[model samples]
Target: MPDADRPQELPARLLTDPEMINACRLRDFARVFRLVKTKAGIYPSMIARRCELTPSRVGEVIAGRRHLLHMDVIERIADGLRIPGHMLGLARRSWETPQALVVTEREAQQPSEPEETPSSLPGPDVDSILAVATRTSLSPATLEAFRSSIEDYWRRDNQHGGEPLRPAIVGQLRHVVELLKEDRPPSIQHGLYGIAAELARLTGWTYFDARQYNQARAYFTEALHLAKEIDDRQFMANVLACMSLQATYQDKPADSLALVTAAQDQARSAIGTTPRVLSMLSMREAFAHATLGSQARTHEAIKEAHRQFERIGQDDPDPAWVSYFDEPKLIVDTGIAHGRLGEAATAEPLIADALRREDHSNQRGRAFHAFWLARTQLDQGKLDQACHTATQALQPASAVASERVSGHLKEFYDQLAPHRQEPVALAFEARLREALPLVSGSTRP
Candidate 1:
């Protein structure tokens, strides 16, 4: 029998590095934590960064004082450290079921208490309102106001990206938290919790797009906790799907696929499974497969996504959160999936068509899609066309505060390294250096 004190040994298959086979096998979160610090030459800050936990929290976990057993947290660590699930006394992760296990209705009831209260975070001023909220009945109109504010912020985020609007959203989140503490009817409380989760998720996604990943992860974790507290399965699935997208952007395709699978499972358990939402999750799976270089799997996921999308009827109860995933999103994402697998010829026209239809107001998204077009051009060895597409991409990229766009530009610069002697390539390289800010190591692709 394996010693209870001993962590299951680290295997060579974990990270696919033969040289790392004999590395630290400590399975305890704390032991693994300390081992990560000691194995600086191998993993460095990969754990803290990829898992979206602060260094201090990782330290606390290593010291055996922090709560590290939550399902989401465990999955984060398992993916980040490339630890096989079996080693952690969990089931195997794969492309099929991935990391999904059904979260039963009984297990998803509202919590008796809030998950974690804010102790040190700065928030909106609500001292006056808090007293009134406790004594008086919560008004439905007031709840409606909060919902409207959140919806407005969502629109703003979609148009402007997250950097410029995060502060306002955070302010709204603080106000909602204050309201949540007020004495109110159970129905009012439920609405408050749902809005709070929505605000938290918005904050997280903005930070994510801005490439402030640790902060983003922290917010997403809070949103997940709130979603669980209220048993809001739809929002739970949405948050998980967003997390999967983040994993994809970070190039952790295996983890991305797992998270998407979990999102799909969560959606299946929701009171009403909307096809729009299911299609979004399936598209995420397709993207993950593409990133992993699985052409067949990518195609399979894409087909499934399309099939679900076709099932959506005119009167389907589509939520506000998923209203953004339309035919345009599908087409663009299909192109992206193919592009990630290096199928430039098959990807370019679809991406180009989507780019033409993309909203002009969404400068960040337009720039992002343009970058993908440039990538496809480069992949096809059309260096001149790539340079031109990249130049057009830089127009909006320069106007945005997103570190992610800058990262893409940086990657494009790397592609130009070989042709630096060519005047067009040299000029674009110089232009990019002057246009975009240098991304920090944490946000670099």
Candidate 2:
């Protein structure tokens, strides 16, 4: 834990041993009490009254000459002043042994650890990325770049992928939104809202990764509502796509299909006005169709998605949330959809490509990608690969606070049970068993 007494800098008040001794004297307690009373705007008599102690006893404590050592008195003083019990204890201890306070004061002035050098810190790449994002107007290319950057961040720290870091990131995004909400231009506010919606979507995805379906649903609902409020049809489509993902994970393929269709309708409505939005919706529609085993419809949807994707030149796409619809991600989703439909062979190459091109920063996406890969490998009888991929997926999934991903892992382990005689399968089963308590305890009531 970080030091509690150390402020950002050292204070100028230096305490000599004699001064410290004098400070610990019984009479000196009155001075301390008076200082606290003045700062808190309360009369010492009033404080004594509240503490159920006479003003004279309170004065005796302040004078450092009070012989009574009742713990209750100490507690009352701490409580009346609203000081933490631990701090109050420390103060009491210091009063008993004045040397301790002197030592503590000395220790507070010294640096306990080596100062971090600038070169040793992570570079300003994220700041640079944000700077670029802020400087440019919304375009398909820029949005894709932003998406790619976020994904790369996830991939770099595989351990943190899929964790509650999504909520933390949302907190940061919310800070930006708050700033934008304060006297920013309309255009800036518009962009900020889009980013907020995107962050909310990511929050939902993170929750889903953790297998917290209800929380995921709430976040997605919020994102969808925000997107609608912003009149950002593309963002709305993205939220819908996530809703489909949530439904699919919950074993509601039919509901997933409906969500995709809704997304597609919204996308089509924005086709002339927002081509990038159309492409995103089309991609989602293709995945939904594939998951539902609508082969011909899936193929047609993919074709349409490709057509729309092709129309979005780097310069032509919308600036917000448009960058996520890339060929690699689309192909990955295609493979996932195929894998769900029991076409492992057809899904393998696409999954491989997605894994290869996946951004490390997008922990949730990478976890899902790995999950689908593991499932496909299992289907193909590549137990070793399947186990390895599943383990990789779990590393990130564990860090994230998402119930959806945990459910996927639960399902994955369930499927692995038939092969429990194998060491890898057995090891995975053990891990899953251990995870059960954590999963059960972490759920929101």
Candidate 3:
């Protein structure tokens, strides 16, 4: 049994009964145990053996004993179960405390109206472009050809100046979503869902590029949910990976690690192999480790990432998001992770290689590369070079729209503040002051 006074190892329940009741009401203990079993697949006896606890104690925890206060034992159980600490913490807190409840007086409550029928849900606007594609005089083959043409056009235009096309594309996708909701034929609905997910992904990318991380998160979450409904595991994995990226940008490395871990599990369950998925997981792990200041783990993850990236071949890979996992991009991200870990000597060379490979066409990648290089230079005490590089990075920072990149720039500026009197430092300070407000929502002049 756990020691009552020492609750550090246990899951996050409070010492009092009210907290325990709340935790029990929320099924916190059960959830944690289940998650543990899910991750480690250990039987009760095996878990007890691994945790060095009596089998009876494990049983009690599984059975929800409110007085079991040995937090260390709980932590050991979590470790034995291979459950992440953050999740274990959530389980403990939820189990131990009554979540604040929203109360409404009976007099304040209004009588409920009749619920709307299924038919009341907004149906596709048949007058829209998708309607034209589905119900038009054009043949199915012609419609498909037209759709392909539009996709190609959008891709090309996006690389140039396609900002104006987004509204139209969003409208078309919304119509498709509506049609799916209205019980369109399964085949047609599936296709429409794919299109909608793609559109949502693009919108999320746009928001991410614009440094609107919260808005990007909403779009990505919607995309992931839609992908799951359609059983598109690959797309689901991509969406989860994107969420991990968003979490990292928000400076929540632990949450980022958890998201990526979940994403990796989802990706593994997907049919067939995906080098890109593996690579993404590897990169996220490496970056998370870097953020957490774990140098050895970061290197290990980067190695695994490179191994996965090496497995990609023209015919062996899923073409969907794999195209974005090219050598240069991978190197740039690796460099960024290393730089974050205070490895300027090692990181500088990688950043140099990445910059050499960077083409102006990839504005987003270029911006990120410049930012990483600037960061590396600053860390190496090359203030003049860092400031100049930061200025170049800031030029495209607004053009791409990534909160992660903006955050990096801000950190770089903060680091340079002690050297503010230097010309290069003053220049960086001025540019950062201008750009910071745009990305960070600060209105101070």
Candidate 4:
């Protein structure tokens, strides 16, 4: 929550500017703070005063010695800088924007029509590409370079967070989209669209990880369009599946189930898609069913997913994107689906196994799995263990720039609410508060 008693007036040079928004979204505080001082004529101490952070800490962060990792810090920065909550992964800040300038997630909850296309969303102006005397030729090497960059950023997202890499992903997507305007060999044109689609999907997924649903949807819609333009049915199915995953988290279980079912149909119609891809889509169906509290349907979907997964082979012509859906990922997601349905006994061991094998550098992943383990423990009445496990997760949760991880921790805190009077629970709450202090009351802005 933002501070309600803060000043009602917003600074004229807040993140309403695209570049500043990109910098903040990328978590480049050093450059951003420096830009504020040099370009906006705002000093560091003044920034500290405005954002409610210590001047020394602000300096450290600006100097690259500290980070803005916690939600409390992010929320404070949003409130102080008059940054829109949509950009910062917080609830809407108490500030007014020009109606012509933005339509927030809250305001745009219901899509205007049954199908919202990319053209329907406000985004980077594709028609405003910088005019050039000549265009560069699209080549296999260039496409491979773009693919390598996307892969590198994907790895970084798994290790660091989606927020820090979001701007880079968006930049890459824009660059690829721009490249499509150049005249290219007929064979290479489709490949360019494929790369653009993948970049768009990556950008959307990064936004999703940050819990910025509207931005995510815009990119996903763009990706879907690009994929369809190339007639790349497999990629189309994958994008639809990602959209379904987004709907699931947004608490629209029926929408999720419908999207996954549509994805399955697309996958079945595609010529070259492997069983691995189908398996991933089926697993998503299990998630939707679990969300809907349909025990029979959930198990049926899970078993179907397993059967499809078993059919996948080493020589299968699966896309690189679906490669992430290995045995370990399946186990983790299956556990999560079961956990959602309150089957703690079924979920606990699988989650623990996945956590044990998880990469230590993947701070976000570990926090996510650990939170699931804690949830299962709490569900099973193992309060002490759940508290301890949640405490262990808190450090990584604080370090990662993921709203999903933050949301999980908040849920853990609420789970312990009933036991607040207990000594262990009190101690746990103290630790959580240290990591993520829930500021009371609202600022005026």
* TM-score for each model: 0.69, 0.55, 0.63, 0.70
Per-residue lDDT over 39-114 for candidate 4, one digit per residue giving the tens place of the 0 to 100 score: 6676889789888889999999888998664334565676676666666544455454554543553433322223
Candidate 1 has a TM-score of 0.69
The sequence of per-residue lDDT tens digits that candidate 1 reaches over residues 235-255 is 888998999999988879899
| Model 3 lDDT at residue 75 | 48
How does model 2 fare in lDDT?
0.62
Best by TM-score: 4
lDDT of each: 0.74, 0.62, 0.64, 0.78
Regions of candidate 3 where Cα sits further than 4 Å from its true position: 1-134, 137-169, 182-185, 211-213, 398-406, 427-445
lDDT sort, best first: 4, 1, 3, 2
Model 3 per-residue lDDT tens digits across residues 1-445: 3466332233322322354435433336554454445543556777678667788877787887632322344445545544333333312222132334212321111111123435744444533555556763323464365357446644543343334344565555555555554655566667666667766766566555455564466567667756776788777777777777777777888987888888788888888857867887789888888888999999999999999988887787574555667788799889988988999978988987988887776654676688789878878888888888878876566564344556666666678768879987777677777776544322322
Task: Indicate which candidate wins on lDDT.
Answer: 4
Better of 1 and 2 by lDDT: 1
Give, for candidate 2, the lowest lDDT window spanning 10 residues.
6-15
Per-model RMSD to reference: 12.9, 17.8, 14.0, 16.0
